[model samples]
Target chain A: MYAWFFRELLPGPLWVRIILTVVLLAAVVYGLMEFVFPWLSEYSPLGDVTLEDG
Target chain B: MTPPLPRHADPAQRSVAAATRRQRRRRPLGAKIMGGFGEILITLGVLGLLFVVWELWWTGIEAESDRQDSLDEFYANMPARPAVSDGDDGDNDDDGPNPADFEVCYTLDDGTEIGCADHMRAQTGSEQIMGTVYAPRLGENWAAPIRYGVSATQIDRGGVGHYPNTQWPDEPGNFALAGHRNTNASMLGNQDSLQIGDPIYVVSYDGIYVYEVRERQVVLPNQTEVLNPVPSDSAAEAEFGVLTFTTCHPMFSNRERLIHHAEIVDFVPIGAEAPADLVHHEPITQMFYAGGAG
Candidate 1:
């Protein structure tokens, strides 16, 4: 899937493709960090810092 | 010889080409499957690692920014200190503004004054900044704004949060606050470093309430008795106010809560000199002295 994405989905020459890949990767990581991860953290126990009454 | 017989024009040559193509199409099914599976696994691994980075690092960045905004808003809304002239130093012998000079901002339901503790009952769900907390023992510049709610909307902003049901500072009850231990700017990241008798200063709009650490314990999340009017003793009436700090225990885990209780030792109303022990974080202490307001 990734190979297909890199080889076919992206356009341009090798150098342009490489830069595009970096940019795309950065956008994905930024989205995950700013949106997906924070929302997922709500359900994850990893960042549960508050206590509750029994 | 004649243009290589136009390759495909010859039936024999066409058959040979077709056979190779068939072989190429028939081979590597298993390898393709395994390769795809490995790619998926690698993608999942990278995503998991990124999630950890988000939790440990990215969250702090966002929270710190939020905390800064909260601090700025709190200071901006703070009442300006009474002005003093340099040449009139002899007339004003006191070091700073006198607490007695400021009007009371909070009182109990029965109209009894709560003094410099600034025991204002915040409306539920209003995530307002209640005060700024400073602990010299925690760090020379360690300070976090305490907000009204303990939920993520408040605590995740890189500051301590007051449990809604808990009492306010110097209110003759337990004033409980919560903070993240390892994430969200780790406001109380060094909570365990507190020592017995260490001073924790809570600077509210009315004044600074000084609390001295009295005890520390690890308790299950449900052991909320620590937030009782009289911590761990619901039956007993609180004779004086106490401060409680609650955070997730064992550093990176939230299986339990690390609790610290501090007794309110003194109160210095706004305009008065903060307790000598209070760490002088300029942005915080400046709000109390003349010309400190912006």
Candidate 2:
């Protein structure tokens, strides 16, 4: 699957493709860290420190 | 296998042979679909691991910096003490300042005085830094800024949060606080290590309210009576202050809440000398004594 992305989907030569892959990977990681993970953690119990009035 | 190729076969013929082999090796439609699914599953698995790293490690990095910034702001804004020599310290065995010497720091909406514990009410949808908490038993240099609310905006910043509904330190009721136990800097990660008689110090704008641990209990998350003013006794009038620290129990899980209850044993006003047993963090302790004549 990754081979297909690298060889066919990316519109670049070998050097350019390597750079693009690194940039894309960094973007994905940044998105996950800044947006997805925080949103997902809201549903997780590990960070639920507050006690609800019962 | 039909016949041996010439020593110098045509390059075009060899290329055709390679293409045919590749065609033969092509997967069936079902296999192709299954392989796609497998790839997706692997990606998801990697993402799950990344999430764990983000939760346990990355979040702490952000929170620790936030905690430091908050502490810096609190110390910078700390009120300077007025020079006044109250003769009460000469004869008293306690070297701490007289609570009466400090002006009232909080009052109810109706203007009823709440005394000198530097009580700051948590506003809805916002947070306020109320103080800093120091526990020698937790760590030698362990101090987390205490904030007004226990929500993500507060606790996620690597600080214990005061329950707005609960009483403040030195008040005649349960002064409850909540903190993350295993993630977001794990402010109270060592809560289970607290033994009976361990001192927990809360240094607010007005003074430091010292509490001695009396009990530790693990209770269901829904068992919020532990936060009551007179814990487990809603009907009784609270005679003395109780400091309650609540965190997710069993580390890395929120199945229950670990609660440590401590009774208010001493109060050292901001201008007074910190108690001998107080956690000796120089900059932090100095903030309390900044305005003092001493």
List each candidate's DockQ score: 0.67, 0.66
Q: In candidate 2, list every pair of residues with a backbone clash.
A: none
**TM-scores for candidates 1 onward, in order:** 0.81, 0.81
User: What is the lDDT of every predicted structure here?
Assistant: 0.78, 0.78
Query: What TM-score does model 2 score on chain A?
Result: 0.84
lDDT score, candidate 1, position B23: 57
lDDT for model 2, on a 0 to 1 scale? Answer: 0.78
DockQ of predicted candidate 2: 0.66
